[model samples]
Every structure is written in structure tokens, then in C-alpha cells.
Target: MFRQTHIRLTFINSIVFIVLISILGSIIYFYTDNKLYEDVNQSLLKSVDHYQNTDGPEDSQGGKLGEGDQAPKFMGRDPRILTLIWDENGNLLAGENRGTMIFQGNEKLIRPKKYGTLEDVQVEDFSFRYVAFKTELPQVGKITVQVIRNVNSEKELLDRLLLIILIGCGVGIICAVASGYFLAGRALVPIKKSWQKQQQFVSDASHELRTPLAVIQAKTDLLFRAPQATIQEKILDVSTISKESRRLSKLVTNLLTLARSDSDQLEMKKSTFQLDELLKEILQQYEEIAMYQEKTLRLEAPEPVAFLADKERFHQLIVILLDNAIKYTKEGGDILLSCTQSHSSISLKVEDTGIGIPEKDIPKIFDRFYQSDKARTEAEGTGLGLSIAKWIIDKHHGKIKVHSIVGQGTKIEITFPKSQK
Candidate 1:
């Protein structure tokens, strides 16, 4: 699914970039073509203007265009300029540079019915821009003046510019496709990770819920079969049902908490509290419970430390660590809780002599529903306690570190700032 999405995103991005590049290339091509064509037109019109101002295409003595005596008068003008004239009867006249030009055209090219507007004439292999005009000179009546200029240089330049624009567009499109694909891949990384995490979370939650549900259904079947059994006679079955139901309830509650945390909806109700006193109270409550489980629980918080934090979440965090320690420790194992404070920060530690976690498993212990025991045989927890504890620590802007040696012991230390923003 993600692979398809990545390709789709890349394709969309590349298409958009291609469209923009095409528009830009077209604008450049058209603008350059217009400018160069305008320059050629201006050059052609300027030649016609000069012809008219210099005696109206006729000798000053009222002779016809291209008379033998008019040759020396235009010999020094632009060599690319070609001047030709025609009479009302369609007779052709030539100037000095007319024969020098290599263009050959029929009557329609020379005898335009109008003037002042430039037009293109392609004669064999040569390109020319020309303008024709007719006026009654002093002696020649209705004589037409044709001014033509060679524009091969401008044509070559426009063709070269078009080629360059096409090449640039091709290169730009390739780069757009490559970069679009690369950036789209980068963008999907986080989304892919989140999707996988969500799938794992749902699978683990379903597995956790299924066990208790199956037990509850079997116990319910037993109760229904013995409808006349006394409450005392069926206490053991009832107790089993109750135990599984409580476990199911706890699992649901943990799932809900984790879901809220994932969506960032878990609000922190923070307040300044005495850290040492809270630890003392928690230790006292768990003291007898640890003794019943045949383990020793102790606390070493000698000073009062006021910390700004979410008090309820802080309590839950400590309880989670303490419960995990008691569950894993064997009979006569020692569990220690300590709180130390400085002016700027407060530190808390939970140490236990338990069946220690492997070093390879320590980093992943806080992952939801992850058990250190590969076979998952211990079965003492829903495996979400440390995950929730990690969330609570993060919410309070705290740092936690785990130190454990296999077969020896495990210790978890946490440090938090005195004030939160």
C-alpha cells in the first residue's frame, strides 16, 4: 500500500512540475521570437524610410528608379538592404544593391497593394523582410518602392534559442521527476512507521483481550450448567471468573490510556508536590504486599524535594516500576526506592534483585506489549506497564535510563527538572 502511495505522490509532483516548466519554456520561446522578429521588422522599415526621405525612390532630376546616374548615390548604404521599384504598368526597376541580393521572387512579392506593414518573402533559399509603398513622385506617377532586408542572422538566432529552450526543458523535467521521487520517499517514512505501529498495537490488544474473554465465557458456561449450586460450593469458579474479568478490565484500561497517549489527548494535571513524601507513602502501601510476596521493599529519601509535575501520572509511573520489580524478583530478593534532589533537578531510582533482563532486551522493554521472555511464559503482566511509565516520564519532560545485568539485578533511574514550561 505504501509503495503505491509513494509512486502516486511522486507522479503527481512530477506532473505539476512538468506543467510549470512547459509554461515557462513557452513564454521564453515566444518572447524571444517576438523580440527578434521585431528587430528584423524595424530594420526593414528603416530601410524603406531612408529610401523615401532620399528623393522618394526617384532621381532628384525626376528620372525613373535605378537610373544609371542614381547608382553612385546609394553605393555606401547597408549592403544587406535591397531597393527595388515598379511602375503602375508592372515594369521592374532595380537599385545598386538589388543585384547583390540573391533573392528571387515573382510579381506578387514586389508589387504589394499597400505599405507601412512589413511582410516576409521566401525566394528559393534566401529569407527577406520587405515593405512596398506607392506614391506619385514629381515625374513618376503611382510608382511603388520595395525595401527589402536580409534576415538570415535573426532567423538563425531564433532557431538556436528554440533548440536551447527545448534542451533546457528536457533536462529540467528529468530533474523534477528524480527529485520528486526522492522527496516523496522521504515524506512517507514517518507515515509508514506510524501505520506499522498501529497495526502491531491492534494485533497485540486483540491477543491480550482474547485470553480473558475465552476464560470468562468458559466460567459463565459452568455457572449456567449448575444453576442450583450454592454460592460456597461454586466459589472457586466464581473467583476464577472474577480474576479474569479484573485482568480483562485492567487490560482495557491500559489500552485506553495508550490510545489516548498515541493521539496526544492525555491532558496533564500538573501541580507542585513534595516528591519525597509521595515516595514514602507509596513505599508504605507496597511494604506489606512485598512481604507477602516474600520480597523486601525499602525507600531511602532523606530530604523533601518540591517538583512541578503531573502528580497523578508521577504516582502511576512509580507504581508501574515498583509492581514490575516485585513481580520479577524471587523470594528474599531486595527492592529499593530512592529519591535524591538538587537545586535544579530531582532524581528517582528503583533497584531490584530480580531475574534481570538481558542487555539486548533492555532497549525495547518500553515498547507496548513487548515481553523480555522470548517464549512469553512468565505471564505476570499485560506488558504495557513500562510503556505507560515511559509515556508519563516523557509528559513530565523527564529522562529515564535502565541498567541491568543478566542474572544479577536491574535498576531504573529517572531525572526531572524542578520546573516545567
Candidate 2:
């Protein structure tokens, strides 16, 4: 599918490039053709004027002749310019043209109309520009002077230019296709990764949701088919049902929170609050659970350190960190929570002497649905807690860092900006 996408993108890019080059090439071709023709026309007009004046009769003192005078001493005509003259009686007179002999038997060529300016004409083997005009002489009747200029040079140039344009267009389209394919691949790398991630997320979410659903179904089935259960048995069954239901609820809530965050709908209610108090309050809630597990839970803070941030998200952040620390720490192990204030930021640390994560897995722990090898085999979690924690801290314009050694301990430090107000 991605290969097809790349091909389609390259094809579209080639078409656009080809169209633009064709337009530009046509404009250049026509403009150059016109300029070449204009140069030939100007040369023809100059030759006609030279013949009309220089070849005429001289004055009494042997000076130049004026207009409308017969030439006693005729000047030679330009070799590139062929002149032909004919009297009103349809007989050739005054000038002979070797080039015009190609149209000797053609009546239209012998008795052509006055076209006033140079016009394009074609012969059997050559192309020419001809102009016919009638000028009266001193003693002779009206005679037509037809000037012909060869245009084979311009034709050859235009042919070469056409070849160049075709070659350039072909080469340009080839390069466009090659470069477009490369660029499309570069552009699709990120999109392909995003698509793979989305697929993985859906599959993982389905697997996680299916576990609780299966438990709920099995427990309810067993309860409905029970053989005369006592009150306490019924109560135990109800407790099991409630536990699974709560687990399912938590899973769904996490999924929904992530979804809202993806759609940019997680509204934050920002306010100034005492970080120390909030941490203490959250730690108090987890202390009993830690004690039940026979782990030492501790909180270290100087005084009431005020900060500006979303209160509910801040609470969630501390809860996630503390809960993870408690879950991973063994019996009789220690979990420490600390908060400190610097000149420009507030820092929080959650350290636990638990089964520390492997060095290679530390970087990927924050990824959604990512579970380290040890966590995957030994622990029970939705694998979304740290992801949520990271997202919350990122939204608060903060940073989180993790340091761990396998089988030793793990320390997570989060830093947030202080309120200027």
C-alpha cells in the first residue's frame, strides 16, 4: 500500500512538472521563432530601401539620385537579396532572379498582387520571404519590385530549438520522477510509523479489555448456577464481581483519558497551590497500602512550596508515581518521595528500591502499552500509567527523567517551571 502511495505521489508530481515545463518551453519556442522572423524581415526591408534609392539615377552634378528617378548607372544588388521586376504588360524586365526561376511556369508567381510588406512563401526546395510593390519610374510605366530573402537559416535554428526542448522535457520529467519518489519515501516514513503504532494500540487495548470481560462473564455464570449458596458465599461472589467491574472501569477510564488527550480535549484548570501539601495529601492515601505490603513509605519536603499548574493533573501525577513505587517495591523495601524548590523550578522525585528496569527498556517504558520483559512476565499493570504520567508532565511544560539499575533501584525525577507571579 505504501509503495502504491509513493508511485501515485511521484506520478502526480511528474505531471505537474511536465505541464509547467511544457508551458514555459512553448513560450520560449514561439518568442524565439518570432524574434528570428523579425530579424529576417528587417533585413529584407533594408535591402528593399537600398535598392529603391542607391540604384536610381544620379543628379546633374553627379550627386545621388532623388526618389522617382531612372538609374543611368545601376548599382549591384545584394547577393542575399534577390530582386525581380515586371512591367504592366506581364513581361520580365529591369532585373533577373535566379531564385524565382523555380516559379517560372506558375502564373500566380509572375503576376502576384502587391502585399505591401514581406510575407512568407515556400518553393519546392527552399523557403523565402517576398514583398511586391509597384513603383513608377521616370520614363517606364509602373513596374513591380519583388524582394525575396532566404529563411533556411531561421528554419534550421527552429528545428534545433525544437529538438532541444524535447530532450530537455524528457530529461526533466525523468529527474522529477526520481526525486519525487525519493522525497515521497522520506515523507511517508513518519506516517508509516504512526500507522503501525495506531494498529498496535488498538490490538493491545482489545487484549486488555478482554481479560476483565472474560472474568466478569465467568464469575456471573458461576454465581447464577450456584447450588444453594449461603449469605457469605453470595457476599464473596458479589465482591469478586465488584472487583472485576472496578478494574474494567479503571481500564475504560484510562482509555478515555488518552483518547481525549489525543483529540486535544483535556481541559486543564490552572491554579496556584502548595506542592508540599498536595504531595503530603496524596502520600497519606498510599501510606496504608504501603504499610499493608510491609514497605517503608517516606515523604521529604522543606515547607509549603507554592507552584502554578493544573491541580487535578498534579494530583494524578503524584498518584501514578507513588502507586508505581509501591507496586514494585518488595516487602521491607523503602520508597521515597521528595519535593524541592530551586530558583526557577520545582523538582519532584520518586525513588523505590524495587526490581529495577533494564537499561535497554528504560527509554521505552513511557511508550503506550509498552511493557518491559520483567514487567510483562512478573507484574500486573495496564502499561499506561507512566505514559499518562509523562503526558501530564509534558502538558504542564515540565520534564521527567528516569535513572535505574537492574535489581538495585529506580529513581524518577520531574521538574516544573516556577510561577513568575
Candidate 3:
């Protein structure tokens, strides 16, 4: 059904285009025909005048004159003549096909007053277009002369030209339909690829959740089997169950957040806030966690730098960066958070002295389900943090940049427009 629908659309569009082109070609052909007729009529009038004034009666009979005879001088070379002359009583005097000339209603030709050429008329099973000129002959006064020429050959040529144009238009339409089909397929390939990736995401997420779920189930079963088990063993089993349950909950939350973000259903409350103050508050919260990990956290900010943005989502972005720094930094490593304002924009930099990222993997760090080896092994995360951060920043009309060197450190810089407020 889809293929049939596409073909129909293509065919209709082709037909409309062909009709437009044909109309244009018809207009041009009519213009050319008018010009050709005007030229031919002018030449015929000049030839008729010369024959009436100069030629004797023998020359008019389609024969050579005698000694001292004068000849008619026609305007163009190789002229084809068809002439008719009428007397005062409406009877033919001299011409080719005289008996077949059917005059329709007292039609008279006037000089220098007509613009377009005359129409075709049938005469004795032959079609012709005639230009009539009135002249006075010295011997025979008030002679009405008509110059008529057959147009069947020219009409046939014009019909053949129109046929060629129709053939060209048909070929063009076929090419257009073929091109449209291939282009539509090429455009849909990316959509198909995204669908496949979504299927794989669901499969991987199910497997990840099952591991923690199975651990919780097995621990509860062991507790039920050993009713007289030692109190210490029972407490250990309860703790393991609680920890795995918490891990599973966190994973589910992360997955749900990603799903909502992808669907564009995550609503944020937007307001104006002091960015400097917000950074200080986030740093304070991270400092406590840094202390427990034996890591030093520091902040640098220009005084009272304000911004208009979504406060809660901005806080989440800061939290993701800080948590990542804490997880990857060795004991006693330093983490710095700073904000700087420029002429039209503000830059927020989060730099850490930690186990840095490899150059090749840096490009894909913010992609969904991506995690570096060191971060994956050392932390409990769903690999959606950076992806979420990127989305939030994009919604705020900002940009993020990262610079890192292996074994040295990594720096993430987020630039926001000052004019956003």
C-alpha cells in the first residue's frame, strides 16, 4: 500500500509539471507561427504588385514573353505563387483554381490595419491561407487580387514538433519517479538504525536489573531455610539484601530519567538565579562527600554572577560532574569548580586531578550507555549521567566541551549565553 501511495503521488506531481511545460511550449510555438505568417504575407504582397505592374498578358499565362518583353520582379528568390483576381461582377477573371474559390461573406482585406495572420479556409478539397491586396491596373481598373498558399505541409511539421516535446516530458517523469523512490529509502535508513538501537537498549537493561533482583531473592531464600541460623549471619544476609535492593532502585531511576528525557517529557521550572551562589551551594554539598573519600574540593567564582535558567536541572548537572570527579579521583586528589563571565557569555569549568580519560574514548563520553573502563569498574552508575547533563545543557541553549590527557586529568567546560536572561 505504501509503495502504491508513493507512486501515485510521484505520478501526479509529474503530470502537473508536464502540463505546465506543455503550456509554455504552446505559447512559444504560437508566437513563432505569428511571426512566420507576417513575413510570408509581406513577401506575397510585394510579388503580386510587381506582377501586375510590369508583366504583359503572356507572362501572366505562365509562359515566356516575345521580343522586347518585360518580366515581373518578385521580392524573394524561389517564390511559390498562388494568385486570384476578380472582376466587378464578382466573377473570377484570371487565377489558378478559379472555380473552387469559395468567398465567405463579402470579406475585404484592408492595408496596414491587420496584425495577426489570416485563418485557414478549405477550397476544392485543399486548405489554404490567403493574403488579399487591392490594386489599380492601368488598363483593367479596380482589380481585387488575392494571394493564397497551401499550409498543409507546415501544419504537419508543427504536429511532429509537439510529439517530440511530449516524448521528452514522458522520459523526464520516469526519471523523477525513480529518483524520488531512492531518496526516500536513503532518508529512512537512519530511522531504522535508531529503532534497532532502542531494541538493544531494552535487552541490556533487563539483564542488568535481573542480576541484583536474583541476589535479593537468593539471600531471602537462605534466611527462610536456616531458621536457627546465627544472629551475625542473619544480619549479614539482611545487609546484602538491602544494598542490592538500593542498587536496583538506583538503576531503575536512571533508566526512567533517560526515557523521559528522550521523550521530551521532562519539565523544568525556569527562573532567574545567581549562578555564583548556586555553584557555592553545590560545592558545599560535594565537599562533605569529598571529605569522606579523602578528596579535596575547591571553588572559584566571580562575585554575584547571575543567570536566568532552570535551577533544579542546573543543580543536577553540577551534581553529575562532581560525582564523576569523586568516583575517579584517587585519595587526596583535588577537584576545582569555577565560573567565569565574558563579554556575551559565561563559562563554567569543572577540573579534577584524577585518573584521566583516553583520547579515543573522549568523543563518545556523553553518549548513552557509555562508560570508561576505570569509571565502570570503580563506581555504581547506569552510564546515563553525562548523557543527561548534555541534554539539559542543550535545552538551556548552551554548549559543553571536554579536554583530557591520560594519567594527568580531565576538564569539562560549559558555556552559556549571557543574553539568555
Candidate 4:
């Protein structure tokens, strides 16, 4: 699915690039072609203007000549510009022409209707641009002067330029395809990771919900089979049902907490709270439970600091930390909670002499649904506590640090602002 989406994105990007490049290439080609043709026309105009303005004639023909004769002047100029003079009787008179005899057949070129108008004529493989006008000369009867130029050089240059433009566009399109594909893949990386995470979350949630549901169904089935039994006789089954129901409720609540967090719906509801007292109150409740599990619990709050934050969120934060410590610690292990106030901030640390997490797993412990080997095998948790705790810390503009050594212990320290501005 992601691959298909990436390909589509790349295709769209490449198409846009190709269209823009083609338009730009066309503009360049047409603009240059127009300029080149305009330049050739300017040269032809200058040659025709110079011929018409000649004062008296050189009269180099001498003698009386034909009745329709004309005296010609020899003024050699650019070899590309060709000149021709003709009489009214359609006879080729005297003119200047230097190169390329490809322009032939003077019959159609001597027409009076073609006077003063620039025109193009294709002769074999050559292109010619010429202008014709009849001028009354003192030394020669009314004769038409034809100014022509060969534009083969311009044509060749335009052809080369067009080839270059086409090649550049081709190379640009290739680059667009490669760059578009690479950028599309880069853009999808985060989305792909988010998708994988969402899949894993759903699978884990289903597995967690199924356990309590299966247990509840089994216990209810046994109760149905023993319909004749008294309430006292079915007390154990009822207790089991109650316990599983509570566990399922807790699981659902945890899932909802995570859902709210994911959707940015969890409200901080911050207020001023006594940091030390909240932890102390929480520890008092957990001390007895720790004793029951053959573990020792202790607290060390050096100063009573007033912290301004979401009191309930801080409460949940402490609960998650202590619960994580209790679940991961072995029997007879010790759990410690310490809250201290420095001049700048409030610090809270939870240390446990538990089956500690491996060094490699510490970094990923806060990822939703991520569990270390010890937690998966030896503890009962949905593996979302640390993730929620991290969220709470981030919301309160605080930082959390975790340090754990395998088979030894783990320590978690959190720093919070004394008062947010």
C-alpha cells in the first residue's frame, strides 16, 4: 500500500516538473528563433536601403547600351547579402552576388507586385530572404533592385539550439524522476512508522482485552452449570468474576488514557500543589501493599516544595512510576521514592532493586506496547504506563531520565519546574 502511494506521489511530482520544464524550454526556443529572424531581416533592410539611396550612378556600363539599359555600381559588402538589378522588360541587368548560386530563375522574382515586401523562397536545400523595390535612377531607367540574403547559418544555429533544448529537457526529466522518487520515500518514512505503531497497538489491545473476556466467560459458564448451588457455595467463582471484571475495567481505562493522549485530548487541568505531600500521601497507601509482597518501600522528601502543575496528572505520573517499580521488582526487593527541591526545580526519583532492564531496552521502554523480556515474562502490565508517564512529563515541561543495569537495579529521575511562567 505504501509502495503504491509512493509511486503515485513520485509520478505526480515528475509530471509537474516535466510540464514546467517543457513550457520554459518552448519559451526559450521561440524567443531565440524570433530574435534570430529579426536580426536577419534588419541586415536585409540595411542592404536594400543603402542601394536605394545611392545618388548618381557610377555609369560603369559606358556606351549608350540598350533602350532599357541601366548603369550599375559595384559596392562589395557582406558576402551573405546578395543583390540583383532588373529592367521592366524582365531582363537581368547588373547587380552584386558573392556566393551560393542556389537562388536561380529570375522570372518570378522580377514581378512588380512583389516590390517593397520581404519574402521567403526555398530553393533546393537553401533558404533565401529577399526584398524588391523599383527605384527611378537618373542614369538608368526605372529598374527594380532586389536585396537577398542566405539564412542557412541562422537555420543551422537554430537547429543546434533546438537539439540542445530537447536534450536538456530530457536530462531534466530524468533528474526529476529520480529526485521525486527519493523525496517521496523520504516524506513517507514518518507515516510508515506511525502506521506500524498503530497496527501493533491494535494487536496488543486485542490480546489484552481477550484475556479478561475469556476468563469472565469461563467463570460464568461454571456458575451456570452449578445453578442449584447456594450463594455461599459459589462465592469463590463470584470473587474470581469480580477480580477479572476489575482487571478488565483497569485495562480499558488504561487504553482510553492512551487513546486520549494519542489524540491530544488529555487535559492537564494544572493547579498549585504540594509536591512532597502528594508523594508522601501516595507512598503511605503503597507501603502496606509492598509489605504484603515481601518488598520494602521508603520515601525521602528533603524539602516541602510548592509546584505549580496539573495536580492530577502529577498524581497519575507518580502512580505509574511506583506501579512500574512494584511490578518489575522481585520479591524481597526494595523500592524507594525521593522528592527533593533545589533552588531552581523539583526533582523526583524512583529506585527499585528489581530484575532490572537491559541497557539496550531502556531507550525504548517508553514506547507504547514495548516491553522488555522481564516485563513480558514476569509482570502483568499492558506496557503503556511509561508511555503515559512520558507524556505527562512533557505536558508539564519536565524531563525524565532512566538508568537501569541488568540483573542489578533501575533508577528513574524526573525534573519539574517549580513554577511555570
| Highest TM-score model number | 1
lDDT of each: 0.81, 0.79, 0.71, 0.80
Report residue 97 deviation for candidate 2 (angstroms). 6.8
Give residue 333's lDDT in candidate 4 (0 to 100).
Answer: 94
1 versus 3: better lDDT goes to: 1
Candidate 2 at 388: error in angstroms? 2.3
Which portions of model 4 show Cα errors greater than 4 Å? 20-24, 27-94, 99-124, 127-151, 171-192, 263-281, 284-288, 291-311, 338-348, 374-378, 393-400, 415-421
Q: Please write out the lDDT profile of model 4 over residues 1-421, one tens digit for every residue.
A: 9989999999998998899999999999999989999977888787777665655223234333233444332332445676666677766664333342333354464333477888877666777777877777555667777677778888888899999999999999999999889989999999999999999999999998999899999999999998999989999989999988998898898899989888988878878878889999999999888999999999998777789998888899999999989988889999999988888888899999988888888899998878888434467777888888999999988888899987778999999877776
Better of 1 and 4 by lDDT: 1
TM-score (C-alpha) between model 4 and the true structure: 0.71
Ranking by TM-score: 1, 2, 4, 3
Clashing residue pairs, backbone N/CA/C < 3 A, model 2: none
Q: lDDT of model 2 at residue 408?
A: 81
| Steric clash pairs (candidate 4) | none
Candidate 3 lDDT by residue in tens digits, 341-360: 88888899999988899899
Model 1 lDDT per residue over 288-363, tens place: 9998988999999888888888889989999999999888887899999999988888899999998888989999
lDDT (Cα) of model 1? 0.81
